[model samples]
Target: MSPVPPSNGPPPIDAATSPATPTISHPKPNGEGEPADASLPDNYVTYQLSRQTPLPPITWGNWYKELNLLHFAVLGLTPLLGIIGAFTVSLRWETAVWSVIYYFMTAVGITAGYHRLWAHRSYNASKPLQYFLSILGAGAVQGSIRWWARGHRAHHRYTDTDLDPYSAHRGLLWSHIGWMVFKPRRNPGVADISDLSKNEIVRWQHRHYLQLVVLMGYIFPTVVAGLGWGDWKGGYVYAGLLRLFFVHQSTFCVNSLAHYLGDAPFDDKHTPRDHLITALCTVGEGYHNFHHQFPMDYRNAIKWYQYDPTKWTIWVTSKLGLSSHLKVFPDNEVRKGQLTMQLKNLREVQEKLSWPSDNSHLPVISWESYLQQAQSRPLICIAGFIHDVEDFLDQHPGGRHLLTKYIGRDATTAFFGGVYEHSNAAHNLLSMKRVGVLHGGAPHGLEDKAIPPSQRLRIARYNEMSGSGYSSGALSDGDGFMA
Candidate 1:
C-alpha cells in the first residue's frame, strides 16, 4: 500500500483540523477587562495552524488495485462459480443455510454493533453484549473496530471534503470500494481514535484482525461442514466464499448506495439519507440520514413503523437486560427542528411566487411576516413555556412551571438568555458550532472523563495476553456482561 500526499494548496480550516486552543485573556485590576495591548504571542496563530498536519499521501503498488479488482471479479463470479461447483459437486442444503445464516449474523454485527454502538456510541450495551457484537464485528474482515470507528468518525467530521477518507463526492467507484483497495494515503497521526483505542476489546480486535476474520469466516464454516454436511468442499464454496461475497457487498452498499439514494428527513448538509431497501440489505441500517443526523441515537428508526430489525433486536435485548443506556434523540426537538426547516422552505417558495394582486388572492404569508406575528402572540409564548415545563416536569417532579407560557412565539432569545445562558447553548453559540441533533449539545454533566494512560496500557497488555492464549480467562458469553 502507498500513501497519498496531501493536496498542494492552502489547507482548509474546517472540522478536519485539530481542535483550536483559545487565547486566554487575563482580567485587569479594578474589576475591568484586560488591556488591548495584551496581545497574543508572536507566531501563536501559525503555531496553532502548524499543529494541523496534513495527511500523508496514499501510495499503493499496481498489484493492490489489481488485487481489489480481482476480489470484485470474484464477488461477481461467485454465483457462476456456485453453479459450476454445484454441477461438479453436490451442494448440500445445510451448507446453503449455514452460509446465509452466518452472512446475516456477522453482517448485522458490523452494521449494528461496530458502526452504531462502537463508532457512534449510539447506545451503551452490557459487556457480554459488547463482547458478542465486537467479536462478530471483528469477523466481518473490515479492519478492527478501532480503525473502522476512527475512519468513520473522521468521515462524519469532514464529510465531502478531501479529508474524508471515502467521500462519495469523489465518485461512486472510489467512495464505494476504491479507497479500501488502493490505500493511497497513510493518514499517519491522523487516525484520531484516542477514545476507542483505549478500549481493550477494540485494541485486541485491531491487532488480531486477520486472525479473527479467518477464524470466523473460514474455520467456523469448515467446522460446521465437518460436523453437519461431512463435505468440506461444500462449506468452502457456500459458507466460505459465497457468504463472504454477499456480506462484503451488503456492507459496502451503506457506503456507496446509502449516501447516494434515500430521503433525508434530518440534516441535509451531507448525502447520508434513509432508504428502506438499503436497510433490508444492511440489517436495518438503511436510515443513513437519521443515523448521520443523530449518530448517538441507538435506534435508527425512531418511528415504530420503520423497518429496523437490528433496532428491534437491540430493544428486545435491552428489555431482557442485555443492553442499557439506549440513546435516543428527543422526539420533540427532532420534529420541531424539521418542521422549522420545512416551514422556512415553504415561506421561501411563497416569497418567490409573484402572483397577480387581483387574481383571487389566497392569504399567502411570508416567513418574516409569520415569524413577526408569531413572536407577537402572547398565547404562543405561553404555550411554548407550558410545553417546556411539562416536559421537564417528569424529571423534576416537584418543580413548578416557573415560565410555562411560551410555546409558539419567538421567546427563544429571552428564554435562552435567561435559562440556557450558562449552559452549553452559550458555548455553542459563541463557538459558532454547527447545529445537528447528533452533536450532543453540551457535556450534559454525564460525560465520562478520559481514562488514565496507565490503565489504558494495562488494558492493552491484558488484551494482547488474552488474544495470545496466555490468559486463562474464558471468552465472555452474552450473559453476565450482556445484562
Candidate 2:
C-alpha cells in the first residue's frame, strides 16, 4: 500500500512578524477619485482550510494473519504439549537427552557460526567448520545463510529507521518475533544480498532452505534417535521440537534484548549495545556495543578474559590450522583510541559543569598535561634515537658504515658493554629484548644491504675514537679486545 502524506497547517511565524505596524489612511477629492478608509493590522486576516487525516497503518491480512497463528501454534502449543505429553506418556529418557544436545548444538551453530562468522565476518573458518555451522544453523529451521546475512545487513544499515525491516521501534512484539510470523509478502527489492546471491553454494542453499531445514531439523533428529534409542519418536520429541524451541528464542534475543537494553560504548547512532546477560545467553554475542563499534575485528570481546567462548573457539581452530586471518585490533591502537574517547568524555563533563569563578574550577589542565606527556614521550624518544643515529653515521664515515651492519640489530647492549661498560650505559641496556644484535633484519640503521660481523666491529672502533685519550681498543671483535 502507498504511504499517506502529512497534513499542512498555517504558515509558520518568522522574524518579520515580531514588530508592530501602524495603520494608514488616504483621502481624495469627490469626483470618482475616493480613497479607502484606514485599515486594521494585516494580522487580522485569518484563513482556515480543513485537511483529510491519513488512514491508519494496514494490519496483517487474513492469509498473513493465519500464517502467524500457525506459527504461534507450532512454536508455542506444540512445545507445551510436547512437554506435557513427555511427562504424562512416560517418554524414554534417551529422548530427553537427545533433545537437550540438539538444542545446544543448533543454538551454537546459529549464534557462533552463522551470525558471527558468515554474517559479521568476525572470523575465518575452514570448510569443515563452515559446513558444520551451516548445517547447524539450518537445523534451527531458519533460512539459508545468505538470507540471514542479507536481512541482518539490512537491519544494521537501517536500524531504528522506518526502512528497517524489523525495528524494535515498531513495537516489541513486532520486532522480537512478529516479523517472521507475518512475512513481508511484497518483494522488498530482492534483498540487497547481491554478493551472496552470486555464490553457487548460497544460491543452492536459498533454493533448498525449507528442505534442508526439515531434513536437518526433523529427519536428522529422528535418525539419531533411531540409532541411539531404537525409536524415531525419541529424537523427534527431544532433539527436533525441543531443540527448535530453545534455539529460536535464544536467537531472537539478539533482536529483542540486544537492542532494547544494553550499554552503548561506541556509536550511539545505532541501537547495538553490550548486554552481559544477553551475551551469556547468546554465547559471547552479548558485547553488541563493542561488536558494532569495531565490526571488522573478528574477536567481539577484545580482552582475553572477556568471556567470549566463540572467540575462544575461533582461536583454537586457528591454532589447529582450521581458520585463518582472524582479524584483531592492535593493542596499542585500541588503547590509544579508548584513551582519546575517555579524554573527550571528560572534557564534555567538565564543560557541562556550572562553574562559579571564571570557568577555571575544572581541573582539566593537569590531567590533559599528563596525557600529552605520556603520548609525546615515546614519540620524542624514538625521534631522538633516529636523529642521533643519523648524525653519528654522517660525521664518522667508518662509524656510519659499521653501524649499518648492526642496523637491524640492537646495538645498545654491545655499545654499552664495549664502549660505556664502566659508565651508566649498561643500566640503559637492561630492559631491551635479548635477541641477537642482528635480530629483526638489521634494525633501523641497516637497510636491505647485508653487512658482515667484521664491518660491525669496525664501526664500533670508530665510535670509540675518543680524541682526548678517553680510551682506545675499548671495542672487541671476539678475542683481540682493543683496550
lDDT of each: 0.61, 0.57
Candidate 2 overall lDDT versus native: 0.57
lDDT of 2 by residue, 209-321 (tens): 78888898889988988897787765776677766877787788778777777766555567877777887767777787677667667776776777677778778888999
| TM-scores of the candidates in the order shown | 0.58, 0.56
After superposition on all C-alphas, the RMSD of every candidate to the true structure, in Å, is 24.9, 24.0
Q: Pick by lDDT: which candidate is best?
A: 1
Model 2: CA > 4 A from native:
1-81, 87-97, 183-191, 330-354, 359-483
Backbone N/Cα/C clashes per model:
28, 14
Model 1 per-residue lDDT tens digits across residues 1-483: 434546964645556565688677563533233332244456543443456565344445444434446445544565577566667767788887888888888887887788888888877788788778887876666777977887888687667766677888877777777776654342322334555656777777778877887788677876888788597888877777777767877888788888888877776778887888988877788888888777888887877888888888888888999888888888877897577556556656656644212101112222243344445332222101111123343343223343334433333345345544334333222212111111121123312111111222222223446442211122321211000
Give the winner by TM-score. 1
lDDT computed for candidate 1 = 0.61
